[model samples]
Target: MSFSIGIVGLPNVGKSTLFKALTKIKVDIAAYPFTTIHPNVGVVRVPDERLDKIAQIFKPEKITPTIIEFIDLAGLVKGAHKGEGLGNQFLAQIRNCDAILEIIRSFENPDVENVTGKIDPKNDIETIKVELELKDLEIEERNLSSPTKLLQSKSEGKEEKENLLSKKPIIYLLNTDGKTQYQVPKIKHLIMNLKDELEILELSDLEKKELGVKSKLDQLILACYNILDLITFFTVVGQKETRAWTLKNGQTAPEAGGVVHSDFQEKFIRAEVISWQKLVETGNWKKARELGQLKTVGKDYIVRDGDIIEFKI
Candidate 1:
């Protein structure tokens, strides 16, 4: 259930700034290329309103939300696959991630250097995509050259087809200047001024609203969650803790239990399940059961988002 997202793009595209906003972990955000030679990693707790509401109802001592790790990798250039700039080092780091958040610079600043010479989001996107595709082609060719090694990988339960970097899910982040007119590429993208977001990051909610600053960091995080097709389930232990857990979509009850604990899957019997909304309306589990809102589900039951489950092991 734990996964990572690689924040990649051409240099000076605000990747590190976005990382700082998402994680509050400062790194070298120079206006030049290769500022982030080594990847900076930080774990971010996914924001969930459901978990907050559940905590308000249960009044638990501890509240735990699911998390996603973000890695700020060095920038890629036009020939990254051919050892240009940071080259394969950046691509290699990206391959290890579950998903990619590609930052496309659409902002123009005289102080900030543009690696691509001019601000063209479409061209920037193509540059990154082609590099990834070329790198994947290289990997595929290398695997074909060593048939024995390729066979070994397949025998070890690795899907050679899905191992390609281009095959991974990608979400484009258009780093805008808030007022500049830029060509928006025809792809899945979110627009935000990374510098502005960082400036307003420490301000209170009311202060942010007063300044007309709308932060899209949460939306970006949720987009990453949705891009991976993940769903969340909750567990509330009376007055002790309320926790949110992540699972892939279409997973079953036993699999959900496994997320809570490895042994819960094998020793699982049945689960006491109730929708989070129903639990909130009924005010308590005991009352929900009394009103016949709680249901018992077996291993075959597919877990739904916002489900509060009590696993029987």
Candidate 2:
């Protein structure tokens, strides 16, 4: 799936630095405010060690990792809702994203001038939240303002109404504690209510470490994947390398095969599947097959995480 996360924050908040760190690619970072008028897009690799084990097991010729795209949109000013600072266009760039990674200015560096003239992480976070809430509210208002209600059939109208009422989920990212102190403010005055309403996750340091296996970059991407409810499966051909494949949770075998190649899906016969645990115990595919530990499944068999699947075509 072409899933993506939109990275948004005020100017000079280190969104570009985070993007560069995540994607390991260089992008234009301006020294002053409003430097990034156009957002930079990057695809970040999702780290998985299961790929190594599967490679050791089946030894596929190639390994494929999953990725999520991130776009660093221009900074939002105080009056973003009022069409200030690339306002509406920036919001529109984020509309198609699966979710948002809100970057709040949580760091205070004397070198990095605060356009607002002060450093307050809470205020920074609240500013972004209020902007997004207003953006969503505007969307909701537009949906309500539509006069062509009769154009849709009864069922479609009901579905549309349901959609207009439901809130889009967001994941809040407080970019590494940057010297700024955390201070709690009044719930109503802050963005706490909006965050709760949207079920937004305020990432904590403990959670980040626990989620990643090695690197913080790896952990952040893993967190994003789990947050999006994505699943990973394995494909091991009898080559030297093994690969990891990602599919939506509950995807069927043929559909999963389609992720590898449409031809694989078309020519599929049956899938010989073994769980990672079974492979670890059985030691090899031949042993697993001999012991009938390998499951011979049809298209309906749901692809699972860590499944070493050898598609029969």
Candidate 3:
């Protein structure tokens, strides 16, 4: 239930500064390139508004959100594919990541040294992409060069099956976009439905009203939500704060209970679930359950984003 991303770039390309900004922890940052010889690691909470709403209803002793593990590894030089310039060590660390965040320094500054000896975002991006592609291609080429030798052994088959996890994706975190580019897995049922042949209209009055809630780093919460592939469910009561809990898309009730604790999942029980769209349309969870919009689903049900679930453990 855990995933990770590797932050990569050339030397002195603000990887450490970006890492500090992300985790809010201090790390070594020097004017000189290669200041960080060892990788810096940080785990960031996946913020979810649903956890608060869920708390509002259940008043749980604790609330937990999913997390993303990030690794700020050493810079990739031109000859990294050939194990040059701390290449083998860095590549080894990153090869295990579920995804990659390539940070390109779009801004220009002569004071800081550029490992490639210049500053250009597009060129820098290409350099990193090419190196990764080269790394992949090298594997592919070797697989082809000695297919009989590598694959003929039975043990090699098991290794190849497990090695599928090593197929990491390269996500470009554009300079202007901040971190949104790599935040979400662009695959979900509801969003897919909404965005299918999507169109944009001018901002509405309601949207303008909602904008006030975002005070700093407006998209940060949304980014965390995406990273977790989470769905939000809310609970509200009179004289109580509306609470939200995070559940993964397509997660079952028992699986979600596991998010809270192993004890809950172990105890075993049914779930009181209501669709958020129904609540908004009907104006109450009681009415939602009455209208058959609320559902009692087993652990096998695939949780959707914006679902309102209350486990009946």
Report each candidate's C-alpha RMSD, comma-separated, in the order given.
1.0, 7.4, 8.9
State the weakest 10-residue window (summed lDDT) of model 1. Answer: 179-188
| Candidate 1 lDDT, 144-234, residue by residue in tens | 9999989998999888777789999999999998777787788878988899989887899899878887888899999999998999999
Selected candidate, larger TM-score, 1 vs 2: 1
What is the total number of backbone clashes in candidate 1? 0
- Cand. 1 Cα-lDDT: 0.92
Candidate 2: list runs displaced more than 4 Å.
Answer: 148-166, 184-215, 263-269
How does residue 159 of candidate 3 score in lDDT?
A: 55
lDDT of 3 at 34: 84
- TM-scores, all candidates, are 0.98, 0.79, 0.67
lDDT of 3 by residue, 1-313 (tens): 5566788888877777666666666788777888878988897765655555545444555555556777888988887888988887888787777667666664445777766665456677667767776776776677679877567644456454334323455555433323223223232211111111111122355764566322222144355346545565554443344445566677677877776567868775877777665666676566677788878888787767767667677
